[model samples]
Target: MSLFQLQFIHRHRIVRLDDVPPQRTLLEVLREDLQACDAKEGCNEGDCGACTVVIGEPRDDGIHYKAINGCIRMAHSVHGMAIWTAQDLTQADGTPHPVQAALRDHHATQCGFCTPGFAMSLFALYQNKVCPQQAITPETAQHYLSGNLCRCTGYRPLVDAACSLNDSPVVTPDDVTLRTQLSKIEPRGLSNDNPYLQPHTLAQLLHLRRIYPQAQLIAGGTDVGLWVTKQHKQWLRIIDVTQVRELQNIDTQTTHVRIGAAVTLEQAWATLACERPELKRFWHRFAGLPVRNSGTLGGNIANGSPIGDSMPLLIALHADVVLAREEAGQVVERTMPLEHLYTGYRQNCLLQGEVLAYIDVPRPSANEWLRVYKISKRQEDDISAVCLAIQLKRDAQGVVLDASIGVGGVAATPVRAHQTQACLQGFAWDEARVKVAQQQLQQEFTPVSDMRASASYRSQVLVNLLQRAWYESQDMRCITLETLA
Candidate 1:
């Protein structure tokens, strides 16, 4: 147990490494040590799909396959899981798997570098269809495939392959043995000579944080992984919170949803979208599937990125964040509005040794209307130039009783538009009142000019989005630029 065992299935067999470096990415391990070069590293960040790989872990029903970016994922993160790569898709007789066959029959490759990533993504989609007995439509295939990019401009054939993958059912080999092996690797603490600590429980995590206050806490490594690969920052101590069972729970009550700090964006969005179907677009646009699968809501909020989409939506929903720390051998928790968590750019109110524990989001009331709008350069898998979320409650006569508006990418931190909210509240829900509120929104903050958008443009877009929300609230068809063009 002291050897820092890294256990996972590769090539249909259990692969264990006991001496892995603390920050080695899965792509590096795959190409360097194992010589499994199918998962290529194109961007070295999580943007490109060339490093896509499917991770399978035991769930209540069966194995759950998730496609993730290998380049930004720590090699040790996949412990007690099964990893499926492009090379593992072939049959024992050396014939191409159905996904590969569909791609081959459809001519889905040009440079052949991105094919492996595309194939693995398609494999996940195919498995997703079979496990849930869901049909794969062209739109579904396209939505799942957004994370991957084809520099050769070869996407039509790949989309065709995805849509036709259902023509042949995917038959996975019996993984009963694999599940048994994974089950035996009980959740024990792991630490290497480099002071990389993986604690299994909340108490252990808080104790470790108190002991090593300087140790960087990592959830999914979606952001911290960049510190190693992109920024080249070497850390002496690291505390990985992904294995903490208490931090991964999702509790839904009668009036609210309590999401653990370590809950992935994919899981949080899934639960939230179930209650609010309008979040489907924002969820998909949050990031590509791989990044969402690896990134956490807590990490996003704690990172304090102004353009981070989750903060605005959560703030608009009047979410509360639970911050915890160890004091005198007992865990102390404090809850506050999510908006108050941030103090400034890339800064938060978290004290030393303190950690974000949970996010509590209240369910929208019957008269409440919630809407989130993210305006980005690309339609998918891109950062928002301007993100806006508005939660408005009206009386039976259509008079606004209460309003909360959150705006991002226009300030040092994601902020609530108090001026705009005040203007909307107690006002009639009409075009004139919306116009006045739009003016208030534009004058509320002094947005900076960045590559994503100019200050004037961000302000204009923020006001325009408010207008769009008003139109939607009134059930009036508002023509968009796309519709006009």
Candidate 2:
């Protein structure tokens, strides 16, 4: 097959490069190919904000510019998008942008290695928040900047710079023209023998999956990018499934919310949090904003990581997944409870040529009370050492009607705490019953020790999580991150 190039708008200039590899990082194209060197590669993972850049995707609402770690984002995945780096903020006359001026005035830059990433993140905040005339509170600023890290200088000055975005005159690029150009942007064509395939429709994606069953599938590339940068693995062929139209819809029905497979975690989290507001804190702790914007809920569940935060939450809510495959030139689909999908550590029961299509999350009922907890080293952008999600329905008399518990970081797979649920089923929703069930919850799984925590620590945290839920049920204030808000 012939080789293809990437075409997109870098800053205000249209850029086209020849024969770039499909799995190449956007950071590679920015620094090596286009020579837009403002974004520096720091962690080479999504954790550090050093390689942050804003990519504008034209949506039905408007152009949504989100901060993403260019070091982990796929180059070809940004076929015809608009990318803005730190250097793109300055004008021809050398007048600094509001974000740059804020950082400089606040003395947020020290050593300057992470400055570009911080500046780009602030630039995104300015565009999405200040430019749109929305409020950028200190809490909002801190939440948006959670993905960025600066070892030399502390976050006080960075927070100051972020909170200061609205004070200055908002001088942003003309997005009207950019949105029009984005509407005209087309998906990059595939070469005859190309290892990279971009499919725009579900039929095309399903047929391609049937033809190339061995092909690796990538939506956000958050996990697969680590395989390349960290583990140094290479793929011969990859099917890009982000463009599938059917896999991007989120339908809010009467009793359930059907989230498409390719829906970004940010969108899904926002939708789910609206249904159950108690999950807002836990959802924000999943990862940094860039990871949330790029990664998908379906991708997280499909990966079947034992420590993934989403699985336990879904299992507790009694969610189901829809898997689709092209069989004998026909499209076939099947749905199963989410807890039954996992087979082993990082393994799932998805059949060959099948792809996860949608996740049906049930809405909370009137008598339902749910609580989720994540015990991690850091409150933000950190993996859970022990994660717990419990949903129980109770009558007005405080009798436990039904109970479902989902837990992670304490088992080979995200297991449902069936024994504990049974213990709590007919019991009164009181401290005595919860105390007894907490002991059963610990015995439900024998956790393994890793760098995050010891086996004993994982086992003990479950008891405390349940205790906190007990306190929350009684409407008493506890030590929670939400109080900070």
Candidate 3:
């Protein structure tokens, strides 16, 4: 079991980075070793699109593909997945992909550093859609490449490249060929004799956890990789859980939908979107497509950030988190509410030698109406200053029967406004009811002051969110009355 270098499955090619060091970005490996320097390092913190690349991860249904930042991604993070850089899309005869063709015809290149990233990101969009696709529209293109940033060229031409919407030559690489080349290399860990740990079963993971209790359990590196790159810290022993088949499952029964801890945010959102269309806005706003594709639901909950975007929805829906620990050579399970899992700021209740196994969200009733809103300084790719999730259940009389208000950025952890919900339980959907509930919420929370927003500002926005939720739930009509202060 290696701790650092990875044998990543890319397009079925086993890309073994045995000599690659831990904390080295994918951009570094591509440029230095592979000499495929198309993906450039812009803002090494993942803010720039110059290092954008599409990743194809194995899913229960099939393969899931999306774009991601290569500059900030750890080389070990691409294990058990397919990585498609801009260079990979070109034909053996040097013919470019359709996205590259469109970028050339449309004159999308300026400094050329960002072009490869843009091309790869757009190629992912092209792969996601149907073959012989229709011309991509401006709005659709913007949505696809929203994560990438272009500083040199004005974004007009680049946007046009994304809009071309033409399919590339139907070229799919043979995974067997890639894996065969990868198999010859030796597995290398991050620390001395601790390469990349790929676990095929729970027993192996438990055994490894006991041996390396301090090891970082990495499912998605979106949050953890930043600890190394931005914070500049090396995690010696890392257990890569991406290869475990059991942890990648999405099981749905009559009572609940159990999303495996390894399930990416994109997968969770896609599943939720199919069942509830109202969640589409939250899913898109959760993060950029690249981040959503790479970040996992379990990782988000386990990170235990007070302002984490995923916690409110899970809390509001009464989701449960399953924790697995090694006990007497057998894996033991303990389920806790998602809210209870977090203890304080960046703190969780997880024990040593324990890992989150799954997130269980109970099915909502037919009459249940659930909505989530994230209030941030910027609409997309920004952390929430005040996030709100409201789940309402109406009775026969159309009055509010049961309601749950789970909010982040207003407390130490993602918390429920129990008093506010109590205020609305038997109340009718009206201005007076909303007014009372709004007043109750003010008493329930004393939000911390931060650089993103002030305590007063967060409080005010939360009140507005409650009122707006009421307005939307009741009807399209809204009436305001002036009152003397």
Candidate 4:
């Protein structure tokens, strides 16, 4: 039984590219399948910049766009979106767009393998030309391009190339008629009319779960797609949750913000940016624009990576995970704290038949201050050596009302330092209080040593991050990289 056919929808229209296999990666499709060879495959696992491409997706709030590593993205993943490669940046008259023109004028290209990836990454920035809601400063420019590695041209010229695209016209169909030409490509075919469950409603999703109990449930394929592309493994039976409409909504009522499991990080961040501007900074550094565009809050939560950055913040915010399962032909939903959602390393409490449906974060009061900090070897596009998120509330008299601290990269799962939180409660937050809290963090966990950082370094960074949180809560200005030199 065929539940539905998989189609690669691009720019509000389906792209029908002939001779491409269903499980092929977007990088391979751009390079080999579609013959658009600019997006190279430097590191097949999404580390290098050679395979960068900007995908244009129509989001509910706005046009959600980001530069994703084409090397790891599956062809079917580009459905219902418009993809722009570096090859699309020039005008019909053969004039280069500002981003390309700037790169050329600045002599940004060296080996040129990384150039196309950088061009596409910058092109994504160029398309969204207006000043971002969170200003794209030099720090952010570095963060955005961190996932793309260039061995030559030192990165200054590339960064300059990005900054110069600020005045360029938007890269949309209106500007270049790019969509009309892109629509000419043919669609890739899925394996043998095999049933692909696309549940649009909560009731339907559950019903299908029972119907296909053995079907593999998929959300964002940041992790699972590797099973196909990198691992060369295929799921004979799989049900993608991306098409489930109910699971993709982000609802904010008077008391809480409910983010559906299928909601992309791009969507969730925008929703949270209004309420928590501080979170915008972490969201920018969460992943490159592309990974953020497709990766989801639910998927990240369900992934159960101990070093994952999002879980620590969600844990600190007292967020809840909602799980949906099929029971005797009916859909049942259950809710629990985000921390309890995991069991151990590479393991989660989720049932075999259940899918994470949504996450709910209680709205913070006006006096409550929340901050999240990720300490990694690199500023962006890297896993955390120690991920810390803190939520603090104080009364008018400067007495601590309540406090919650969550730390990752220190244990089997993202965990809250309840004991540390207890030590800070009711204590006057002076230098003395900071010292005690910092010392308590050292006692919180014995972080495992890894290549990104040593256990001692991770421990120290956690303490430093908490102290920084203390200052940030006070709106105190501190020295940053820009101020150092």
Top TM-score hit: 2
Better of 1 and 2 by lDDT: 2
For 121-198, candidate 4 gives per-residue lDDT tens digits of 776666564334234556656756767788874699888767766655444445233344445533322333444444
Q: What does each candidate score in C-alpha RMSD?
A: 1.9, 1.6, 4.5, 4.0
* Preferred candidate (lDDT higher): 1 or 3: 1
Q: For residues 301-397, could you state the per-residue lDDT of candidate 1 as single tens digits?
A: 8898999999999989999999999999999999999989989998999988899999999986888898899999987678999999999899998
Decoy 4 TM-score against native: 0.85
Select the stronger candidate by lDDT from 1 and 4.
Answer: 1
Error of 3 at 371 (Å): 1.6
Better of 3 and 4 by TM-score: 3
lDDT per model vs. reference: 0.87, 0.88, 0.77, 0.75
Worst 10 residues of 4 by lDDT: 1-10
User: TM-scores across all candidates?
Assistant: 0.96, 0.97, 0.89, 0.85
Score residue 354 of candidate 3 by CA lDDT: 87
Q: Which pairs of residues collide in candidate 2?
A: 1-193
Candidate 3, 114: how far from true, in Å?
A: 2.3
For model 1, which pairs clash?
A: none
TM-score of 2: 0.97
